[model samples]
Target: MNEKKSVTRLDSTYMDQYDAHVERQGRKKKRLLRRLALFALLTLIVTSSLAIYHVQQRMVYAEKKEEYEQLQEEMGSLKESEENLREEIELLNEEEYVLEIARSNYFFSKEGEIIFKLPNEEPSY
Candidate 1:
């Protein structure tokens, strides 16, 4: 077996400067990569939050639209009911309508008036 002689490397000023320059370049590259990754993460979070907000707003709008339509239908029915009640009030304001209702339902009689009641069944001949 031939024994190999270990040649010692001599450290020079130029070699030291080159090593420092290489180390600085490596650190700069690592910093640039970290900044890029952080920027990408922030952009993803903002876009996802915006998308969720948009969906929620759309859902709220749909629910409000449905509620509005239901309210509009209720308003229409209430108006019809109000008109019917107003007509009834006008009829009841006359003395004749109250007299007729009392005479038919409560057996009320005017002077020399006779009352007769008949069954409400249909007769077959």
Candidate 2:
């Protein structure tokens, strides 16, 4: 076992006042640190939520943009089909076009007209 010397302290009004002041300062420092920590946590939570919201909005915007492009392409194709159908309707309204289709498909003949079926053969080159 080791022996240690004990020291004696003087009791005075100045020492007591200084100790009280030191204790008050320590408490003030602790309160300041706690406030700073709480503020930092609040800032982190707000920033994280904002970042997540920003990312989700960007994804929704991208999907909408892609859908709009697809719809535009489909609209173009539909417009082309409508134009083709209109042209076909005009053709079918003509008497000559109707007669030609009947002559070709239904073996129809005008006066002194002959119909022949020829073999479709490829020549070996």
Candidate 3:
């Protein structure tokens, strides 16, 4: 009877140690789970922030592209105007073209030519 009681006591002590070990393991598992949840949340936040930043960058690039196209169109118009002005300058440098312009715009004639004068009508007011 004495030996049986000693064996029973020893079994109970071992069972208590086993239970403590299981509790420690459970606490460790809970801690690991909490760390994993925190890591996942942080990852989600970083990914979302990066996504938003990329979207904004794309929007800025699109606006700049539109502005560049507008500037290119204005440059084309300015180039055409510059070419027209250059041609006019070349024409004006020639004496014949200058004389033609003067004759047409000012009605100029060679020396000793007849001049016609037209009478103007009186104003009503």
Best by lDDT: 1
Our tally of clashes for model 2 stands at 0
Model 3 regions more than 4 Å off: 1-11, 114-125
Candidate 1, residues 31-66, lDDT tens digits: the string is 999999999999999999999999999999999999
After superposing candidate 1 on the true structure, give the runs of residues whose Cα lies further than 4 Å from its correct spot.
1-15
Pairs that collide in candidate 1 are none
| Model 2, span 1-125: residue lDDT tens | 68797888779999899999999999999999999999999999999999999999999999999999999999999999999999999999999999999998899999998999776898778
Q: How many Å off is the CA of 67 in candidate 1?
A: 1.2
- Candidate 2, position 121, lDDT: 97
Task: Write down the TM-score for model 2.
Answer: 0.74
TM-score of each: 0.78, 0.74, 0.75
**Model 2, which residues run further than 4 Å from truth?**
1-18, 123-125
Spell out the clash pairs found in candidate 2: none
Q: In lDDT terms, how accurate is model 1?
A: 0.97
